[model samples]
Target: MIRPKWTPVAWLADRMAVLVLGLIAGFLVGLSFAGDGRILPAATTVASTDGPAPSPVPPAPPVAAQGVDGPIPPQVTARMRRGGVLRVGVFGDSFGNGIWDALYRQLPTSDGYEVLKFAKEATGFTRYRTLDLEKRAYEQLARDPVDAVVISFGANDAQAVYDDGHLYPLMGDGWKRVIGQRVDRFVAAARSTGAVVYWVGLPVIRDPQLDADMQAMDGFYEAHMRRLGVPFVDSRPLTLGADGKYTAYLPDSKTGRPVLMRTGDGLHMIGIGYQRLTSGVAADLRRYAARVRQAAGRPAPTPTGEPR
Candidate 1:
């Protein structure tokens, strides 16, 4: 066969390009598939702690006082008064990457709240059922009595399977039921520690189907948390783009551009991505912190204690 003069070079280049593309595609697939095959191990740390424990029941703070008008919300006011050591249990899989670390750095040095994390991406409620990392954290926090506990881990669970090994239905079905069960267990575990529960909703995903599943889970948890009187933070609105999907692979809020939320593999967020996410979370925490102060009638100080 007569070959063109550039055929050899072109063929080599083509092969190399295919090889690179294949590797990249494989990585993306791996990231999406990570933890899908393995059921998150059940959490087994539910053993109750001993001795006199602080009040686990988050009491309604005094109603905004008799006539004092504060910028803080009622919940914030209540939280401020009860403030002591805030032991936060950040729970989830890779979704939690940079979550705790970022929050740790952003926390106010003067807030006096001690934060603790119990997050591990790829692990879900199914894992918690047996392993119960949150329960362990609760017991740990109870040793010193943490004022609040923040739970964030829905990216994996939104499309995850239950203990029975059934994939949650495409719409609403056994999957929702199992997910609800998982959430219930998680809430109960965290609340049992007497720490006020703060559940974070799933943020938007790039994929449409995943985004829908995430919203469904978020809605279910939001309603459940409200009904149970637990505090729930919805992160979707903050992360969604004009198309109404997760826009940041790595986000640049200032420029409104997708910087790099996920790693090159698309499973984890890079440092910058985590930083941005934590910024949003920190803002929410600041808002909640203000609420705690107002509710508790405590004086407001800078969250970072030195001008944002």
Candidate 2:
């Protein structure tokens, strides 16, 4: 058999062709292993919205299971059994001032109840950058512990809020969620000290628009407090008449004659108004105290005929 002699250039070219083939085979094997023998299409690019998508609203934390069913803590019952002075902390905006004053004057002193007021006028949780109510309440709790806390706000919260340089209008869902989270934080802070929280809702305001806003805010407060197993007091019905209208005067308990319940500003309450407004709140506190005492197996004190 006769064979043609190969040139060095031809041999080199043949070797290069073999090397190229080997490289192609190796690449195909690697690709098959990477994709598990399945073919994938190229990824498609999607155009985003005009601006950054709004952040997903965070879900509120699950309600604490401890007190949801309304059982008083043993620590609270033990304190009640000690028969020492019971300290109540009143904290919030100016609306709280009248409530605290009325509670201090009317809460049964014979039962060893003392009220400590810590309200700031024209401040709320919405303007947290300016004044954080949760931080303030936490600081106060650290300074002096109280058996219970009374909170009333929203008077100054119905306004625009500047968050991260974005202005959110009042009474919007986003605004309400932010405010609700703040309330949750404050209530949690107060509860951390083993103190019961009583959130008082705002009453009807004179301005129809402001009144509607306040009513909406009250819904937020009530929902949060209920979920947290805290007591919520709605003062609107107390200030409103049977026709669901805001009244400056209602029949006084002492006298059947009409007595002024609201101040000229329509947002504030006069002394007599506060006196009447706080009566129901005082009753709730008394009932709570009684429950604590009863839970501790201690008999509640006999009535001294004190006018709540």
For model 1 the local lDDT of residue 179 reads 55
Models 1 onward score TM values of 0.57, 0.74
Scored by lDDT, model 2 comes in at 0.66
Worst 10 residues of 2 by lDDT: 33-42
Tens digit per residue, CA lDDT, model 1, 1-308: 67457464674574344335434533343343210011010131111233222223442232211111224334334445766323455655555544555566566456645556666545565455556655665576556444455666765454334343233332344445555555666666665544455565555555565466667776777765765566566665555555654554534656756654554432244455444545644555565555555556667754455411
Best by lDDT: 2
Where does candidate 1 stray beyond 4 Å? Answer: 1-85, 128-130, 133-138, 158-172, 243-246, 249-258, 271-308
Q: Can you write out model 2's per-residue Cα lDDT over 1-308, one digit (the tens) per residue? A: 66568674775574344334433432332222100011000022211243333356776766754332366766676777776555678887767777677777676577767688887765777678878888888898888777777788877776645555454556655566567677888888887667767777787887776688788878777777777776677777777765779888877777667776665556777666665666756666676776676676666566566644
Off by over 4 Å in 2: 1-54, 61-69, 81-83, 291-304
Error of 2 at 245 (Å): 1.9
lDDT scores of the candidates, listed in order:
0.50, 0.66
CA lDDT of 156 in candidate 1?
Answer: 48
Tell me how many clashing residue pairs each candidate has: 36, 0
